[model samples]
Target: MEGFQIIRWLSSDDTAAVYEAAGPRGRRLIYTVGHRPAEPAAEFSAWAERLRGVRHPHLAAVAAAGLTDDARPYVLCDTGSTTLAERLVHTPPGVNEVVRTTTAIADALDTAHAAGLRHGTVCPSTVVYAADGTPQLTGFDMCAPALVKTARPGLYTAPEADPGPPADVYALAATAYVALGGTLPYVGDPTDPALRLRGITELPGVPPELTGMLRTALNPDPVSRPSAALLRDALSTVEVPETVTTGALPVAVVGSDVRAVSSGMTTIIEAVTGEQPRIGREKSPPMPPGLAPTRPLPVAPPAPKPVRAKPVTSKPAKASGRRTGRRIGVAVVVLAVIAAGIGGVWLWRDQFAEATEGSSAIERVDFNAIEFTVPADNDRKVTLTGGSATSTNDDGRAESWTLTDGPVFADGNHNGDQDTAAIHLVLEVRGSKRSYVLLFTWDGRPKQAQQVVNGVCDVTDMRSAGPGIELDLVSANPFADCSALGKGDTRAETITVAMRGGFLMETAPHEGATSRCELAPGAETRAQDGDLPVRVAADAGAPELAEDIDSVTVFLPETAGQIQWHLARVTLADGTTTCGWVAAADL
Candidate 1:
């Protein structure tokens, strides 16, 4: 009799026995007692023959199969030291590991599908990892039907549905769900695949990056599920970045698979890449520039997402014109799908935004003018009431404010470039719901909050600084004197400031409009140089000016160029400051 030693029984059920055994050659093997399907498919025998010859790193290799003396069929397959289910019982896999495993399983299944085979049964318990952690799938032709006593419904789809490709995807998602969330997706009838799907809906959510894919995979209707490869791709896209720059608007979909939510973005994306965002069954490849939706997506019906046969080791190649046209067609589908579906980049974005930004509300409003009043110069209490113009609050509330004077151009405390103008808003913020109009500068720094107060005169403007952005409330209306101008003195003012390249150089607040350069050095009105000679300017009239270069550096020693200030605000390397109007005809 051929002899092999049975070292130990690993697990057992009425239908099968898993044992650790040493072969006659002394090679270790996993021996199972079941081969005859309890309810085999029509092609069971042929499929078994094919599976026996097919080999893959992720699938267990069939060592041998035979009929025992008791007339029970048995199959022996190569396996790792432990199964995924066994290891997870003792220690939980981190979310990253779960992602890796999910990708590996998908790759294997996709490979199997290409070979005209399906896992039929894919679950955590059926996948064993080598001592080196490479997963080997064991259940292929072994997938039990409704009549089979040995099957894990907690990790599989219903047998009644034949649990096709999407079923395997569902199982992989369930496994990922358990790993990342640290809990089973469903707990009730572990044998009923239908009930399990229902239970999945009630379980705690997975990591957001995976939530949408899992939800779709877990759908009871197989038609609703995305393929395993697409599920893998979805998971791959969901990494929470370590850091995001401050003040950057939520532009790209922070963590989602959808390229864009609005149709407008699709146009921009197509214009940039000459390709559109593909959606539904065949989503287009990523455009050259990475644009993603910021919304959380739901289980979208299968869009023809391209399945990669080889591992995604390199960046995707640029789309061909043919592919681009196909992508454009897919984009057209996206607009239609978006209407029918309640998910994708927008949903993911909303979920993520809520998480990162919380429910705090701070809004911005830009108006020509807003006027606030302070009864006393030192009085912190203020009231906003001035001219009549219209605007809308963040909450879409109708409000009005007026500009009593010009938008003044001042560097304030020398924080911003003096060339950038600041406005003097003197209009009454008129929203009954808004008792006080919160004032913030162009950069969103709270300038001054306008409120109500009365009592004294000589009102002075003030500013406050904090760890974050500073706040300032510039005063608009100025009076001649208490005796000359008493209470309710109405002043008509128009605000305009001359700005060069967004910098407020000077503000003609007195004229109630912005005009001219404020730095005219009264003595003779000239120009000088700054410490660093980055720029140069010249008088409108200088002989041979037409022949001179557009701009040049005089400090470089031999040039026709410009000036910064008439005052010695800029010192040279020799510790001497330079002033101007020397009037070099050509230098």
Candidate 2:
């Protein structure tokens, strides 16, 4: 590119080196050069030419093209703002903003495909939000001849066209899906190289209109998907309002920065008060009668009549002194016996209750209304038969059942109680397994309880012998080496718990048994050795597995709240890896 000058190298992938470049007019453009060997470079250049031929306002324009110092073929294109992924973490766009962006990209894809060029890479990283807030499709490294070879992951690829136009359409839809809400259409192995490929071919439930378009675009039969032009036109017609208001924007965005700020604020508050900030507001109930409102002191009534003492005037002083001494001694012995008896009874009662209540509290929870069903290959649904679990009385009894189809629930501030304000029911359902837990105080008690199955209680503060394993997925362990994992990325690592407490891996690349593995963003894996197959995803932190381990030990911090991990399968280009639960005990 004669008009483009490379400022500095930014980053590189297997196929290309991305550089910060400035155009002749000084406009910033990302200059990407294909890795040597000529073939890939030629492919990229031809693809760039094809994209340039099909002009789309939402697509980056190919400014210039040629070789660099190393004779590596390169293309200069407009450098939009950071990727949508970065923006979502720092400042997520409103739902309406997402809709508009998605619609624009869809239109661009439709137009490009109509002209026979497929915008191959359509992940969040490739989609950039321009300074003016428009979403633009930037990368075209994988773009191929529309009628020749399929270029992307099969999950996100279309079955028809050999490498058909519908495949691009599927990618467009997938990209839009993520843009709408930063989650994938299907919840599966994020590390699996095959996931995107599978997503391309499968028709997952998306927005109704988008869903229909994707269905057409992802048609296994090439003839069934809409042409790029037609798809673009269809997307253009999508009636996305200017904005979608999600009640109120959260105080913080949906990523680590917000979390860090919140944590720091909490630490500062706690340092000043010497106590952790309560999750919910605290309110004191009204005081009872006869108690002083300010200090709870009981008022004494006037002294009784003193006139009766006058009649008992004078008796023998010696008789009076002896009688008084004898009475005092007897009273002291009686009081001692009574106190001892009371203490014995209290101790006996406590022991008896402990023995009888063993494992009974978990049984008291009612799981009759809980239903489990698998709707897809790697997704599960847990439905409750009722609207919500309500308890009219503050006795630790099941009053109502709250049914949530997903892992998150809104904390409804009802009863004008601020302490109950942020209490939400968070459910984590993966594959065939189902678990429910109350996210707030149950029955006005400070002791928070989690429901492992339907009625069983897994106290977060203590481990119990329940059906689910009580593994702390977020505890820090200094002994385990987790350096192999990348920073700021989340991935699920499979831990196998064998019958003899010996752990074995079905797949390897973990070079050492004591080595640590970092989870890739959105990475999920499935546990293969457990009685029930569980899906696990790394939501935070790099966890370490010990060498020659049969049972995977997850150390949880005492400060950790409700944490969950779902098993998923990680499939790479070479092979698949499956990891599951160490034991079936609930936490």
Candidate 3:
């Protein structure tokens, strides 16, 4: 501080002044100090020392710090030409420029946090623009206590400091907001001292991605904000490309005129003059692979020559000269007539040749137009064959058939449900690989259908079943009723079954009491019987039961009710049993 001299005043309100200082080698560097009268001299000295330890591309490097001659405390840092605020006001910066500046500031905060320091003050004015237009952070007088505790008017202060990371995040976000257009999201004047002190906590207008990030940074709860390193990582993902605006072209010409011309005219002019014309019509110069064409120049036309005619001579001899002149004139007339006749015939023949050539060119046409029309209905019908069916015995009997040569279908509406009518059937079989699908009419009600190939039901595979014959469910919401229809062993014998139509049914509860219930494959319950598990008789014929019957899970309330069980002994026979239970408060 003793070897420093004030060269210029940067700002009166913030008491930022530029000074020149000589180091041990007599090398002079511009040093800046914030002249805050409110800060004690000793506290300011300590804050400057803390900042001096921080090194980053964005933050101004601190050279020295101490009490001035008049008992005033000052924090010395690298002095630069302008502030980011001044740059924004004077020169238009692109999004890339803004991103570069903001990233620098973020890096500075990272370095400060690493050095056990936090920038208490972060605002547009605090960011100084270097001579090369790079923005650097300055002013560390208010950096004591690690983070800002009390609200400083017109300065962006974090919610809490307490030597934590969140405070730094808030300051970084404030700097970023200023870098990107400097407009607050909320309805308030950003320049107002009261509003600025309040900080940009709620920026709903910011992009959702940026808003989410800044929200974390500006979290009122310091514990929620990310650390400086984490903030830098987050900023890395921000796609801060060059700013785009209507008419935000790079070159700034105060008064410029632009015009358009036809490509045909441009080509003709360019050909005749050998000069490349403007308006992007100049023929590209022959270029080697990967090389670009050089800018074309206009060609100059040949200068015209001045002509001088021979003087006419007056006739001298009268008689002999007159007779000779008449003979010569007659001969010239005869030769002119003959030449005119030949030229006429030649012109007529040339016209005829052109016409013939034009007609012949039509016959040798190089291209033809082809048109295609889709039928209004756009409906197709298809039938598929060749599938195998197998039966399984769990607590109950169940059967499964799988097919793998049908067309793939989609809901089209993306509602996570399947459309049965949209199901296209396999048409004219080209080969095993390609299966044609036919479109059906859409019914108002929800229809369930599957693109049945050879007979293997496609369902979600939790594990690796094998290669080439995997069963998977295309729909996110698989049918609860159809869950058990895909489990079975593949046998050699083929089984044929037609689509028997599908309908939605309310699942019956296994217990008599009404409660939440689930169905397991190869399990069924009788409507008449209570909650009793019935065993099927081996001698009884098979009952005509649903295709997939898993175990029925019933949530029973503690209420007195009758429960029923159905036992399917065979394909066409069934027996029922009933029981009763009382609902208990605690079961």
Candidate 4:
């Protein structure tokens, strides 16, 4: 309502609140805000600036974004009546609708991606239908945390694994899978970090014609996925080939030109992001510990007070009548006991359900507390340099590492070639707990590792990521020559480099960047380190919101300091404090 005319409140999540409104041009648009408090000022500016650079028919236009006098961040965009998500919930779309929607979105994605942009989160909800049934996408240029706030987790690809076209294609194809198959691409629980472990293994049951297209888009390596234009163009023709045209960007033709475009886009992205390019997932900064959800949690209802039995009275006249009274009293007691048992069961079920759904189910990864690695190849003929090193955190804190001893090289099976890698391991460590690792591999030539995980240079932790590690074997191995197409000739059986200990995340502090927090239910009340109760949503149902709350019970996992992660929060009586298992995800 700042400058637009409000029509009605539409919907909201922990990260944003949406409303229908009339723009200054008399056209309609959706207004969204980082409604949660203590959001980063820098992040808002970055998201807004990127939004300004994007324009497409399929993409919902960003009409406006800015800070209010109170410093609330808001964004206004084109609105649509029914999102693919909402529509599917009521009735699944026909094949024709699915094709048309996917085509339009691909065209939009191609335009944005070619210009070096990505709709970090592309799911059914973002693609809404207009009054005329035309589809348009909202929530462009959203960051990781915001996307997590809005998106259905486990549906989107983890960016740390594969950024760029590959990840975007996977999301689009996944959306198509949901639209056509009436379910997500991967059927298991979306919250489980290990859910999509195999990476598009068993393709979703789709038309025989569309299978190859989806597979190509869903390749584990970004380098292998076809461009949005290529895939969309291939799908348009009635006669599609097993392999489409322009598979590898014609590394021959667009080689230099592609690099130029990618380079410029990279420069702009780096400037705005101030972090390495996360492959697929959105990166949300962590909120301070103990803050109430910017979005309120569903507080537990007051415990049903036990009903006390009424006292029996003795005012008998005859002996027979007294015997009858005793029998009647026993029946009353039995009936009361049954009623109490039923009430207890009902209360337990209500509390159990509330404790598992919505933000109550989400887990937060603390980026600050974890450590990561920065690896490099000691190019001195099989030498791996920067093995053991120490780096400073954003707050000028120090992190130490145990690196591979100097000249760490193993002999290769092929002609005594040195076997080593030019990878900088950026690991996120949580004490002795498992650490998340990303491999930064550079060989002065484009390769799979860079395409797969964006070389993992900037992230302290990846979005929706569980515990795992990656290695960029392009530079370190001595067996393979510096050929663009032929590297890493040393097969794993050839040799191995010994290492001690593990990794953590870090980046040199930005000059002007200030710290920011994630979306909170309210002014944050950091829960003390212990048990925090939150609801975990099932794979099918919508996560419910809290209508009212007396107080909140936050269940934080041991990963609190590792990834700025937070589980969903649960509401309880104002003074109620306790812990117990209500729901769980398949780890």
Candidate 5:
């Protein structure tokens, strides 16, 4: 209500009302105003401070929190308009959806608990999905505990006076129950203090393993309930039906971007551009830490977000502050402009063809109308009409290539000109997919693009590499079966691809790699001597180490760190050699 253009009331509770509002720049946001709080302004502000301090990918970050003009506490969170509650009304989540949502929220709760703050509230209404399909936990209330209990009792299945971590666990389990097409056992009014969640009702075809885990989490005894971390791990093991996971569900939104309507849910939010609602906008940076909204909003209109000269194609570096929330996703208008500038005019004689070399900034080009020729494959040419192209092979099997993402700008030729853009495409043949990167230059008309590289297994990340493009190529494990690659039996190596002499070339993306313990290549180290372990990758979550390894030989240019995980030639007891990642401490 403070200079924001209110669109409509979304949902409300006894303590506060939530509204869908467009901020000064016409960006949609979730605004909550609390009408009643057991504590005064100072207590509410302190609670908001705690929320601001904790940051996680799965947490719906608080952008602003302070008291309203009428002394009511208000909070503004960056989240998608749709809620889990609204989604359930339209799409009953499949087993995969249930597991993923449960695991993400549980991990989020565990992270919050580790920070010494209790969410104190976890419900369907509080969980939101970002544009990228990442689930986030929101609805951290500033209301006092007693007031929450008297107002929204269904949120907590446990009878604890002060809901803590255990209470959060129980609530997540209950929410999962509802998400898995199982209705809660509430008989009457959900807010009635006398009403209690008796037990979960099992849905037909739902896995007993999942139901059993929820039951354990829904245990009445706070001591008996599984911790959020444990619940997350347990859910990860449950089997999901493949058919259910692959089916599409109707998406709901609160704006004019609705694309389709069905029986249960009215509309789905498809942004003006095809992009989904991003996690955070560059305009809404996190408020300064320790600067609580104690002071009233300025009499004049709030300052508008700074303008950018060009649309950002890569994730920006996170800003530093006490409250560090990641600002992600490029704006819809920027994407729209890129699409309109490129997608709308791909003909050779379009307006972009008239611009001189230094006339103005080069409009970003989309690859939909661009023709790509694979130089190495007998000069095979494939023309993309609308981001996709299909042709029959020699054996009459249909092969297709679709442009998934891109037009990321880089000076591929390194000629001090930003004329080159990298486009990512997916090639599907016989139900198998391979990622390929195409380099195109817009001189006057669309220049002939080259299909530079194809992933032997899969390409994970692609970003600008100064005057080139860097990609993380994952190679499948040689010892494993063909399906093992899909199951993540792979290793990562960063490589840079650049345009040299009008041809794409590959080079080492980065320099200056040194091993921990100051070891050089060919150095020998005894491993597995005393419970030492080796993994598939440098990260801890990589596959667990094999048990038969006897010793390791240091490899050159290991990942740099004080105690880094180094790539080494792992020698097994049988005297065979294979490469793996080992930590410096183990050596």
Candidate 6:
């Protein structure tokens, strides 16, 4: 290790090698070497660089990261002597311990999420307890495409697409379930995404409220999962019986954060091979036009390995059986097509917009081929051909509008099918611009249906919200000056848009209710009902954590018992301040 002494190797798997290492100043640290990808070292370094700035007390900070002499990606991080996985093997965590530990982890995750980072490999292995017994999260930014394989790394992975923030929630919930002594929900082939989506088995002895929250976190639809901050709040309110904390293992240990390489890793390698189909094999029916194959065939079928309830250990995990064979000869033909570049889209679109039969044309249409119209000066409209348009003003100042995302299909037309497509476009002018959501309908071709401008903010993500569209918006602390907002400044909020009376409009709050405010952290507001108490927890029955509040500065807003509550720092009448949950109705 670079300038570090490897005390001993803790674990070695096909995915990574974990070791107890001594870093600068003899600081005990855990070093990891994950399976290298074909991509350049700079790409891995870039991600590691990003993780360096994401700091939290509960997050294991990346001390150093780079490639080894052999080009394997390695990271040195702060950690405790043992991992959550090792602790679980002995004593299952009591309900109270699960809430406290998971809440801390979720809060830590929320901090990273706010900075636009994701802990793609969250699991028992990544959650390591500190010397004082507080868990700290490790393995940030380790889920490179090549490393993401079957569900075997840990049984707690999101089933839908590549791991994202929502996936992290699912992983945390699964980890908590296991800590509470629940059986691993997944069975059958480790590489199957369908197994992850089979729904979690009920956890005996768990509080109903906690179980319900976990159910939502494990929903097959990622969009429906709550944010890390929301989950933390909900978990805090869970009434778990207070019990003695479990004892730690005497010997030191830590688990690898990277997913172990297995059958799925080979699937990636096979996709790019140049092998040809054997001659004289029985012919199979051809795929319909416009549809593309998701994966290519392996050069050879791998031997089957029995499923095991193995926590990612110090040994290399065995590869599962070759993906249920698809007529051996037929696989060779598909691989040949991939080898010839005819299926180039398969490389990136493996999980992009999976449009199945009976889906609307909007789901399958080529967004790049559609032309659009954008606003220009003096009520003029600039026709954008090929997804972008640029114009020069009389003063010779160049302005441009380019499509950034979308073709997001939703049933905005009141029809049974999701025929309306929403595309996102960004304007670059004088370093001050906003995004627009352009809605289009297909009548033999894409036709403009409606257009809506996003409030002066950055669009981080967009997805269908029933018959509407939900946009995750991010802005700087002082949002009034959008130009000052740099890439790393990350205060954010979400908004939804829907079609009302043949026009796309921002969805309003229910009649007598107010929507969550887009207030910056520490934004001050006055309390309306001073008599109402601010509780220590989100639940109404929880003890008051703050007293004699004069005013409050709110951070995050959430709902409990159909009432809105703001997690706020309350200023007392005597000039002292403390943080607690303040009801929206009281504020």
Best by lDDT: 6
Quote the positional error of residue 101 for candidate 5 in Å: 0.5
Model 3 has a clash total of 45
User: Against the hidden reference, what TM-scores do the models get?
Assistant: 0.36, 0.37, 0.34, 0.37, 0.41, 0.40
Residue 166's lDDT within candidate 6 is 96
Give all candidates' CA lDDT scores.
Answer: 0.35, 0.34, 0.32, 0.36, 0.49, 0.50
Clashing residue pairs in candidate 6 are none
Clashes of 5: 0
| Predicted structure 2, TM vs. truth | 0.37
lDDT agreement of model 4 with the native: 0.36
Worst 10 residues of 2 by lDDT: 307-316
Clashes of each: 46, 50, 45, 76, 0, 0
Candidate 3 global CA lDDT score: 0.32
Query: What tens digits encode model 5's per-residue C-alpha lDDT throughout 1-587?
Result: 23343333333345554444434322345666654542566876676667678889998776676665555676676654345654554334566887888899999998888877776667665677764668888756533332232323443345565678998898888778766666556534445434454767667667888999998898767899999999989988888774452222222211112111110111122221233332112222222233322122212111111211121111001110110001111010011112112222354423344532322133334457666553223225677877899965445667787887676565443444565566777767666665566555555544543122322354544555445565544444221222333322333334455543332334331111111122322444444542456554444544544446667655433223344555555555543334555656656
lDDT of 4 by residue, 415-442 (tens): 2222222222322222211111222211
The order by descending lDDT is 6, 5, 4, 1, 2, 3
The reply for model 3, stretches above 4 Å from the true place, is 1-5, 10-46, 69-71, 145-151, 159-165, 186-208, 243-587
Residue 343, candidate 2: Cα error in Å is 65
Over 4 Å off in model 4, which ranges?
1-3, 10-12, 24-26, 36-43, 144-152, 158-164, 182-185, 191-207, 238-587
Model 1 lDDT-worst window of ten: 327-336
Best by TM-score: 5
lDDT over C-alpha atoms for residue 479 of model 4? 12
Worst 10 residues of 5 by lDDT: 324-333
Q: Candidate 3, residues 11-46: lDDT per residue as tens digits?
A: 112233332232222222344333334255565556
- Across residues 544-585, which tens digit of lDDT does each residue of candidate 2 receive? 232232322233323223334322222222222223222223
Show where candidate 2 strays beyond 4 Å. Answer: 1-5, 24-26, 40-48, 68-71, 144-163, 182-185, 189-207, 240-587
lDDT of 1 by residue, 1-587 (tens): 12343333333334554444434333445555543342334343445456566767777777665444433445566655444543343223555666677777777777776666766556555666764678767656354221133343333443346756777887777666655543443444546655555634333333554666777777777788788678767777766333311111111111111121111122222332333333222111111112111111112211111211110000001110011111100100000011111111101223223333321111112223222322111122223333354544334545444343322222322332221122333322331211112222323222331111111121112111110111111111111122333223311111112222222211211111111111211223223333222211122221111111222222211111332211112223322221212223322
